[model samples]
Target: IDGGLLSPEAVAADPCPHGMTRELCGLLCGDDDPAVTVDPDRPVGFALALDCQLAGDSPELLDDAQLLDVVEGAERMERWASALRTRMLAVFADRHPPGSSAPPPGADSGAAAPVGRWLPDQVALTLRVSLEEARCMLAGAVRFAHVLPATLAEWEAGRIDERKADAIAHATSVLTDEVAREVEARVLPGAAAAPRRLLQDRLRRTVARVDPQGAARRHERAKADRRMSISRSDDGMASLWLSAAAEQTEASWRSVDRLARSLG
Candidate 1:
C-alpha cells in the first residue's frame, strides 16, 4: 500500500512538534502528486527533484541517439568534474591549510590540539564513505591540484581520465616540484598514444636523472613497505602478490622460471 504524505494520520504522527503543513509536505514528496509516498531507492523526492523532473519531461521511449548522447555527456562531464574537484579541494585546503597552526596563539605548544584533526572522519560521515576511503580521495584531490597540473589540464580537455591523471601524479611523487613539472610536461604530449607502463618507466628514468638523490631516498622508504602475501582465489587457485623493488622482483621471477624449467 502507498503511504500518504499529507494524510491526517501522518501529520499527527510526525516527529515535528508543530504539525507539518500539507503544502510543505506536498513539496517534500515529489513524484506526480506531491502528496504521495517517496521510495528512496527509486527516488523522486526533494533530493533528486531536478533530475527526476527533467527525466520525466522526456518521452518514455529512449532511442539509440538518446542513449549515446547520455554516455557522451557523462564522459565529457566526468572529466570536467574531476578538474572542478581539484579546485574545490584547493578551497578546502585554504580554509584548513596543512601546517596552519591548529591552535590559536598563546596556547602552550605541547597543549595545542590541531584544528580539523577529524577532517577525514567528517568527510566520511558527510559522504557516507569509510574513513580510509575518504583519506584516499582527499589524497588524490591534493595530488591533482598541487602535483599534476599538466595531467589535470589534460583531463579537463577530455584527453585523459582520472586514473591516468592519478597515475602521473603518483609516479612522479618522489621528484622535486620543478623536476616533477618537467617530467609531466615531457610525458603528457605522447600520453594518449603510449601505454601506461611506458609512461611510468619514462617517469622513473626522468626521476633518476633529474633528482637522483630524492629517487634513492624514496626507494629506501619504499623498501621499508615491501612484503609478500598469498591468498586463494575464488576458483580455489593460489595467488601471490609481492611488493618489492622492480629490479629485485624481475631477478626473482627469472630465478623461479629457471628452477621450474630445470625441474621439468
Candidate 2:
C-alpha cells in the first residue's frame, strides 16, 4: 500500500487472513474486514463492491470480493499519471516564466501574454483535448505545484485521488499562504479516506475558521461578478447558469418553488 516493492517470496509468505491469494493480498494490503473474502479470480468485483460500499449502496454481485486488484492498479496508474502531469507543467512553467511574457525565439508573433498563453495550444494538440481543457489542466497543475505542495505530495504518493486534490486546491485558492497551509494541515490527514464532497465541506469549515474576515472579503468581491446566462443546444434544450450570492440564489429558488407549487 505504501508502494514499496515486495519480493515474490515475501508476498507469498503473507497471505490474506480472509482467503485472498498472496498476490491480491500483497497488492491491496488485505481486505478491510476479516470476514469478507476477496476473490482472487475477480479482483474487479471487490473494487466495485468497495465503491458501492463507499457510496452507501450495495452491489448484488458475488458478495463483493473480486474487484480489488483492478481498482488498486487503476489508482496506482492514476497516481503515476498525476505525477507526470506535474512534471510536464513544471517544464512548461520553466520555459514560460510568469514574469517573462515574451514568446520563444522564432515563434509566432501572435503568441502574446498572460504568460504561457500559447503553451496550452501545444498541450492541447499533444493531448488531443480542447484548448480550454488544456489550459485548465495547466492551471490545476500550477496550483498543485505552487500553492498546494502537500496535496501534490499526497497525490504523487497515491494517498488521495486527483479529484480530491482539486477540491483542496479550489477551496484554498483564495486564502493567503499562512491560512491556506493551516486549513490544509487540518483537513489533509484523513483526506485519503474522505469522500470528495465531505472533504470539500471540511475544507470550507476550516477556511471559515482560519480566516473569517478573508472569506467575507472574498465573498463580497465575488458578489460583484454575479450574473446569469443561458446556453441552448441543437435539441431545443436549454441550461441556465446563475453566478450569484448563495443567499440570493436560495431565495430565488424558494420563490420559484412556491410559484410552481401554487400552479401545480
Candidate 3:
C-alpha cells in the first residue's frame, strides 16, 4: 500500500516487519495521540503507535475540524513551552559567563569547589532539548524579545540554551506594541467598548441609512451610556450610577430609549 493512502487501521498495524524506532513512530503519528505515550520503558511501542496514526490511509482521519482543534491547541502549548524555555535560559546565562571558569561572587564557599561547581545537572528539565539545542532556542527567544544584547551576555555565561532563546523571541514578536494596540482596539472599553462593536457599527449605519436624524440622536445616546457608570454590589448585582447632571441624565434616558426602540 502507498504510504500516503493507508487506512487508520492499516497504519496501526506494524507496517515495517523489520524493526522501527520511537522517533520514526512519532513522525508517523503527527503529534496529537494521547494514547501514544513516550518514555524510556515503552519508547518502541509509543513510536509504533505514532507511526500508525501518521501513516493511516486517509489524511481525513487527522484533518477533520476536531483534528484541527487538536493541532491548534498543541501549537499553543508548544509556543508557551518554548517561551518558558527561553526565559529559563536567560536567567542561567546571566549567572554564568562564557570562557571564564570562575563561579559567581557568592558561589564560592569555605575552601575550593570544582571548576564548574555551580552547574546544576538539571537546571530546567521541562526543556526536552539538550543544553546545546536549548541555548540556540534561547538565542532566538532573546532576539525576539528585543533584549538580544543582554540575553547574549547571559548565553555566553553557559546558563541558557538555544530552544529557550528562540521561544522568548517568538513570544516577544507576537506581543509587539502594534499587536497590543490591535488587541486593545478590539477588546478594550475606551473607544470600541462593546463585545459586538462590529454589529453595533452595522446597526448604526443601517439606522442612519433609514433615518439620518434618528441615527444622530442614537449616536448621542450611545455616548451618554458610555459616560454613565455601572457599579456592582458585593453580591454581584450591578447598579447603573447615572450622572446627577440634568442634561446628562436626559441624554442617558434618550440613549436608553433609542436602544430599546432599536431592539424592538
Candidate 4:
C-alpha cells in the first residue's frame, strides 16, 4: 500500500485510534502528505498515515499507537488554534480600533469585520500536527476567542452578573447568527480593548467587590496551605501527591459543583 492513496474504505477497514471515522481522518490529513491526493474517496488513509507520522512512529498510523497520537494531536491542535486566534485578533485590532463608534462604509451596516486568516503552508509546517488538524484548531480558536472575550470582559468589569456571564459564555460557543448579531449590537460597539494592566485591575476590582472578605480569606488560605509529598508504590511506580487544606478543598469542591450544575 502506498498508504497515501488508500481509500476511506481502506481506512474504515483498518480504523485509526479509538476507531475514528474516515470523515474525521480526512479532516485530520488535508493535503500535506506527499503520497496523498485530495480525492474524498481516498482521503482517510492519507489522514491515518499522517497521524501515524505525527505520533512519532516510522510506520504510518499504527493501530496500537493511535490513542497516544490522537491525544498529542488534540493538544497540538488546541495550542496552535489558540496561537492562531491571538495572532488574528492582533491583526484585527491593528486594522480596526477597538472602540470605533462609526460603522464601516459598506453594504452590511451592522456586521463584524472578518476576523480570521487562511493558514499558509509555511505556517502549517511550524504546527506539530497535519495541516487539516491545524485548520480545525484554528477554526475552534477563532470561535472561542472572538465570542467569549467580550462577555468575559464584561464579567470582569462587574457590568454583567456571573449568571449572565455564564449564559454569554455558553451561548457564544453555540450561537451562530442571531447571537452574533446581538453581540455586535450590544457588546461590539464601543468595545475598546483594554491594556493588560487595566484588564487585570478590572478583574481584581470586580472579584473583590463580588466578595471582599471571601477573596481575602481564600488568598490567605491558599498562601498557608502549600505542601508536597512523594511516595513509591509496591508496583515500582512513583507517585506525587500535592494537597491543600480543608478550607481550600471545600472551596474547590463547591466551585466544581457549581460549574457542573451550570454545564448541566
Candidate 5:
C-alpha cells in the first residue's frame, strides 16, 4: 500500500543497502532483491537499471559502450511507440476506410462514399486528446508510416529522433516523390548529429534546392495567407496571435519591443 512504490520511478530512487542512494529510481525497489547488489552510481547497477527499463541512477556509471547503447535504446523505444501509434491510427482509418465503393446513407447508390467519417472524433474520445491534436497526429502517422521510409529507418535505428523525423516530414511534404528521396539522401545523414534548429534550416534549404518551383509556390502562398487572431488565455489574459512571413513578423516584433522599451 506504499504510494511511492506504485511506479518504476519510485523503485529506482530508493536507497541502496550500502546507505548511498540507489542511482536508479526503480531498480532497487519492490522487495524483489536485486540479483546483483551494487550502488546504482556504479556501472553494474546502472546497466542493471537500463536492462530492467528503469531510469539510470547517474550518467557517470555508464561506460562509452553503455552510454551509446542506453541512448540508442531510448530512441529505439520512442521509435517503437511512434510505430505503434501509427498502427493504431491505421486501425481507426480503416474502421470504414476512405475509399469504399459503396454509397453512404444520404448518397446515390453508384457514388463513391467517404468512409471513416467518425475517425477524428473517435480518436479524440479514446485517446483523451483534443480533436486538433488527434487529426494532426493521424496525418503525421499516415505520412511517416507510408511515405518516409528512409527517415523512419533512421529513427527506428536510433540514428535520429522524433523531432528530426518530424522536421524531415514537414520539409518533404511539399515535394514530389522523386524529389523527396533526393532530399532524404542529403538530409538524413546529418539529422542525428545536427541540432534540430540547424537541421530545420538545412532541411528547408535543401527542400528549396531540390524543388525550387514548389518551394517558391509555398512561400508565396504563405505570404498571401498571413493571419491574425485573438485568443483568451486560461489565466485571464488575452493573446494577439499573428502569423506571416518571417521578415515581416520580425520587423513587427522589433517595433513592438522598441515601443515597449521607450515607455520603460
Candidate 6:
C-alpha cells in the first residue's frame, strides 16, 4: 500500500485534466484496476494534492517524508500561535494586576472594584469570548508563565501543544511550586504524545506521590461540596447529576437501578 511517485516521463505522458497525472488520480479511485483496490490501513498518497489544488496551485508530487514534513510544519506553527497567545494573556494580566481599579477600554470605571476584578470582563470583551472562557484562559496563562516555566518552555519550543501544557499546569496547580516542578520533571518528557486521559492519570499519580497530604485534603474539600441537581433539556429529557462520596454515589445508583428494574 506504499504510495509510489510516477517518473517524470510517465507523468508527462498521461497528464490528467484534474492537474494530477492519471496514475496519481488512480490512487484515489481504483475502480478500474482490480489489483489496485484501496488499502484500508494506509493513508491515500495524494491526499494533500487536493489541498494544493484547492489553493489554486499546481500540486507538487511529494514523497512520504515530504508529506510528513508538511503536517509537522503545520503543527509547529500551531504550537507557536498557542505560545504567542499565552504570552499575550500573561502580559495582559500583569498590566491589569489586582487593584488596578482602571477599567479596560469600552468599560465603565465608575464602580470598578478596588482590585482588578474586571480582568475577565476585559478579556471577554477583547477576545469576544464568554467570561468563563476568558477566566480559564487567563488562569492557564498565569500558570504557564509563572507556575510552570519548564512546561511553558516546552510549549514555546513546539515540543508540546497547548493542551499538554495546560494539563501539566492544572495537575500541578494544587502542589507547592517546588513540588510541582518535581512532578513536571517526572511527567513532562512523555506528555507531548500521551493521550489526554493517560496524561491526566499520570499527572494525578505523580501529584499524589509528591504531595499525598495535599491530595487527601483536596479530596476532603471536594467531599464537602458534594450535592445533587437535575436539569431539563428542550428535548423533553432530564439529566441528573450527583456529586457525593464515591461509595455513597455507587450505593444510590444501585438503589435506583433496582427500583427501576422492579417497576419493569
Query: CA lDDT of each candidate?
Result: 0.65, 0.70, 0.45, 0.47, 0.68, 0.72
Model 5 over residues 209-260: C-alpha lDDT tens digits?
A: 8788888889998898899999998979999999999999999999999999
Give candidate 5's error at residue 136 in angstroms.
4.9
Off-target runs (Cα >4 Å) in candidate 2 are 1-64, 95-122, 130-136, 233-237
* TM-score, cand. 5 vs. native: 0.60
Error of 5 at 261 (Å): 2.7
The candidate, 4 or 6, that scores higher on TM-score is 6
List model 1 lDDT by residue over 1-264, tens digit each.
Answer: 137555666656764333224335445565464422222233212323332333334524345554444444445556667666665755565566665545433456675555456566656776698989877777777766777767877787656677677778887876667778888888889886677788778777776877788878888999999999998878779999989998989998999999999998
Candidate 5: stretches off by over 4 Å:
1-72, 84-97, 100-139, 234-236
TM-score of each: 0.59, 0.63, 0.25, 0.24, 0.60, 0.63
CA-only RMSD, every prediction: 10.5, 9.8, 20.7, 20.1, 10.0, 10.6
lDDT of 3 by residue, 189-242 (tens): 322222344434543343345456654665577676555588888876988876
User: What residue pairs clash in candidate 1, if any at all?
Assistant: none
Greater lDDT among 1 and 5 belongs to 5
Q: How close is candidate 3 to the true structure, as a TM-score?
A: 0.25
What is the per-residue lDDT of model 4 for residues 1-264, given as tens digits with 9 covering 90 to 100? 235555767867875664334434554466444222222122224353445344443234344444554544444444334444445643434454434433343436675443233232223565666767665545443443555556544433333333443333333343454444354345333333454344444544544554567567866777776776899889789876657775876787798789999998
lDDT of candidate 2 vs native?
0.70
For model 6, which pairs clash?
A: 99-115, 99-116
- Stretch of 10 with least lDDT, candidate 4: 34-43
Give the better candidate number (2 or 5) by TM-score: 2
